[model samples]
Target: LPTSSSSEDFHESSSSESSDGTSGTPTLEPVPSPVPEPLCWEM
Candidate 1:
């Protein structure tokens, strides 16, 4: 379940990043993972 864990971690970090104005970094990581596309775009 590495992907699941990684996605969760990405979300947690992304949430924090969203408040910091550096959200782009987290979104970029998920761009290559098709499953995370929606999540990334939503952020």
Candidate 2:
């Protein structure tokens, strides 16, 4: 299903972004976004 594919894509994107964020950016960008995740129901 496309929704599954999109979820996979989103996960990959998150992994990539997290890796980049580890380089120097605020780790908070990833680690503390629990509140925003459910709020964004878009694909």
For each candidate in the order shown, give its overall lDDT on alpha carbons.
0.73, 0.67
For model 2, residues 1-43, the per-residue Cα lDDT tens digits are 9999999998777567767646434654655575578567653
Which runs in model 1 stand beyond 4 Å of their true positions? Answer: 17-43
Clashing pairs in 2: none
Q: Supply the global lDDT for candidate 1.
A: 0.73
Report the C-alpha lDDT of model 1 over 1-43, residue by residue, as the tens digit: 9999999997777566675677766666666676667777999
Query: Per-residue lDDT for 7 in model 1?
Result: 93
> Considering every candidate listed, which one attains the maximal TM-score?
2
